[model samples]
Target chain A: MAKPKIATTSLAGCFGCHMSLLDIDERILELVELVEFDKSPVDDIKNFTGRCAIGLVEGGCCNEHNVDVLREFRRHCDILISVGDCATMGGIPALRNTVPLRECLDEAFVNGPSVHNPDGKYPDDPEIPLILDKVYPAHEVVKIDYFLPGCPPTADTLWEALVALLNDKPVELPYQLVKYD
Target chain B: MSQSVMFMIDGVQVEGRAGQSILEAAGEAGVYIPRLCYKEGLSPHGSCRVCTVMVNGRPMSACTSPISLGMIVENDSPRVAQLRRDLIEMLFVAGNHFCMFCEKSGDCELQALAYRFGITAPKYPYMFPKREVDASHPDIFIDRNRCILCGRCVRASKELDGKNVFQFVGRSAEKRIAVNGEALADTDAAVTDAAADACPVGAILKKGVGYVVPVGKREYDDKPIGSDIEAKRPAAGS
Candidate 1:
């Protein structure tokens, strides 16, 4: 049987979840044997080549580009998994949910101690992704089939979930394997 | 000393002294009933209902409900566990618990209970309510965003420290922990006080001492909370 195709991405996150995926260490060799990588930073594939069996999204929707990428994954993948606290519950980025967007932007771009905006300008570049009013977990924007909650889910958790999904077995998570941070 | 009272918890016989709660007796028997807001050596407020169990076929807070002679308690059941998970989920959404950036992430009892209940994500909608972070104290910081309102700090201050520096202000959704005075610095509260350490969440944290424990080495890293209680501690003179 052909190996299952897996695509992964990090949107408003620190890319720590991807780091934990790689923390699987030598198990990456076994992972390769079980599933094929597609549209993932691991393979440096910029776009999805075909339909993927699973999509691992690591982060919440913080901007227009994040929503675009997340919706695109939902459209192209058979199963979508929110793979970290950010994707699951907006994590640290969602802290801005409490503050107004205009205030946050002003603080960051205009009145910040290090900012030298003599022109009193804010980012209005056409190329920059428009920031959303509030950071939202992936499930809030797009349907998420599963969620592995952690700042970066331990490597063992990622590996176990992947192994179970690939083999058509139930994901049996141990107490120590699950954490928020 | 009071005579021991015998009880059955989930079909296992456990014994405790008169006036002891079911939760305390269960702990002595090496049983863990998932709970928050019920710290030992403090008054039981029965605030967080994570430790809800079936006492004689009726749901009751194990921490606040006293165990009587021959009382039957059901600690672990699908219904009980689901109740716990639901309570935990409520706490998660009610508070802006951004665990990744929290100073008390790994060491937090609330987070640990969530992990124990296998909660991947709360089923409730995120409130994301605007909260305050009071950094006025020279040695402590109170981030209302992470407070679960368990009243552990309130009890610790009034009962243990004898300072009565903390109290609950407001009501319902507006309820929150508050230092008695204008600022925590002006109050009798100190960083070394038991109240600071009594917080189950990251609401009250000691300043200048964040993340000293590495990400994976903090409390509840390799084991679940209350692991010590269930470790079959040796009896006296063993």
Candidate 2:
């Protein structure tokens, strides 16, 4: 029988979670034997070729493209797990939640001291994804089946959750595996 | 010495002095009843409700509820555990608890309770309420965003420090900790006051001393909260 497929993505995150996934080290060999990659940066697959048994989502929805990608993952995967603080609770990027969207844009595009945009214009290219008013955790956008809470959940946490899910065991992580920072 | 009163907590017979709260009795008996507002040397405010336990089948804040003779109390039960978890979750969602960046991440009682309960993320939707951060004080800062409304600072200021430096303002959802004066700096709040150290969350912080304890070396980093209290328990066979 064909092994189950796992898809992963980094939306508005810093890609630290993806680095932590790679932090699993030699376990990647064991994981490759257990599951196939689909629609993930791991295999450089930009789109889903088939249904995935699990989708590991990193970061929260910070833009229209992030929501679209998250919704796509929800549509293509049977189980979706929020992989870190960003995906679970809109981590560092969500600091903008308290600030007005216009002010944030102005600071970045106009008011910032280091900004070189003498045109005093915001990025309005049609190709650029529109930013959302507020950063939203993955579960707020779609039904997240599981949440691994960490600032980029430790590599052991991701590995343990994956192994448990793959083995059809309950994903009850030990105390040490669950951390917010 | 006061007369001893007998009570049953989770099927274990425990003895306490008259007028002692269930939480105090449980502590003496080596049962760590989780609490946030009830601190040693301070009056129990019983606002946080993290220490809620079943008293005669009814839920009551163990910190404020005095134990009576022959009283049957339930601590560490599933129903009470779930209640505590829900309370902790509400506190998380109600506040902008960005633990990833919070200076009180490991040392915070709220964060440690969440860790003890193994809460990955709060089940409730984040309110993300707009709150203010008062950095006016040169020696200290008050980040109202992380305030859990536990009233520890309020009590500590009035009762311990005798300064009345903090008090609750507004009503219901608008309620928050307000300084005695316009800002914390305007008040007579000293960095060394007990109120400064009484906050269970990152709401109150001393300036120039943040992240001094590295991540791995911080309290509650490896051990669960209340482990120190639990350690007072007599060995199983002793």
Candidate 3:
């Protein structure tokens, strides 16, 4: 049987979830044997080379770029898993949802206590990706097959879920493995 | 003289005191009924609805409903667990409960309940309502964003502490816990007030004491909530 291809991306996230993935320790060796990596930061692949069986997304859509990347992943992967609080429900970024977009921009750039942009300058360059009105979970933009919730799902949880998928068995979520924070 | 009430909870015969709530009897029997608005020593508010149970084929809040002789109660079933999960999800979406950044993450009862139910994602849409954080109090601050509206603080202030400093303001979507028609800083509330300790979420916090306990070391971090009550099971079996 062909090895399953897995793709991962960190969009509008702190990459803590990816760090947790590496926390799988010796299990990475087993993971490599069970699946092939494609279009992931782990392999430094900038774009998808072929269809993937699983796409592990680690953040919500905060910008147009993230939305495009998520849509691309949706088209190329058979199953897409939201892998953290960010991907599942926008995490900290979603906190800005309650505030007006202009106020947020001002706080980040213009009127911030540390900023010296006297002219009230804002990032409007064509190279910059447009920010969405509000951060949106990955599932809102594309179909999410599963969600692994955590600031970064504990390494044990990631390992257990991956092993379960590899064996085509039900994922056993032990009490200690699942956490919201 | 107190009368003994026999009941069956999930097919396990249990004995209780007459006029005692089903939740209280179940607790004495070492069965943990997940609840948020039913704190011990406090009046049963039965607001959160996380402890919904089938009492002789009728769904009722275990905390408010009294136990009876030969009563049949259903606890720890798939349907009941799902209902609890749904209530937890509604609480998650109803407020700005960002567990990752919350100081009350590990210690939060609502978050712990959600963890107990293994809620990966809420089935409801996120309602990021604009809420305010009242830091007016000298020793405490009420973050309206995280309040689950369980009225624990109100009851605690009035019933336990006798301060009557906290009360509900507004109705329905606009409803929130307020400080006796005055700003928190202007209120008579103190840091040692039971109202501060009564909040189940991060809504009411003592100033300058956020995140004192490190992550992974706080309450409910390694174990599920109500483990203390459920832990009594082994001893009860003896």
Candidate with best TM-score: 2
As a whole number from 0 to 100, the lDDT of residue A118 in candidate 3 is 72
How would you class the docking of model 1? medium
Q: In candidate 1, what are the lDDT values of residues B139-220, reduced to their tens digit?
A: 9889999999999999999999999999999999999888889978779888889998998889999989899999779998
Residues forming the 10-long window of minimal summed lDDT in candidate 2 chain A:
A172-181
Q: Where is model 1 more than 4 Å wrong at Cα?
A: A114-127, B233-238
Q: Is the docking of candidate 3 incorrect, acceptable, medium or high quality?
A: medium
Q: Worst ten-residue run, lDDT, model 1 chain B?
A: B229-238
Residue-level lDDT of model 2, residues A80-157, one tens digit each, is 999999999999999999899999999999999899998999989999999999999999999999999898789999
**Which numbered prediction scores highest in DockQ against the true structure?**
2
Question: Across residues A85-166, which tens digit of lDDT does each residue of candidate 1 receive?
Answer: 9999998898899999999998999988998898888878999999999999999999998889887898999999989888
Interface RMSD of each: 1.2, 0.9, 1.1
User: What is the number of residue pairs that collide in model 3?
Assistant: 0
Score candidate 3 by TM-score against the native: 0.94
**What's model 3's lDDT at A70?**
97
Q: Which runs of model 2 end up more than 4 angstroms from their true locations?
A: A116-121, B236-238
Residue A152's lDDT in candidate 1: 89
lDDT of 1 at A139: 92
For each candidate, what TM-score against the reference?
0.92, 0.96, 0.94
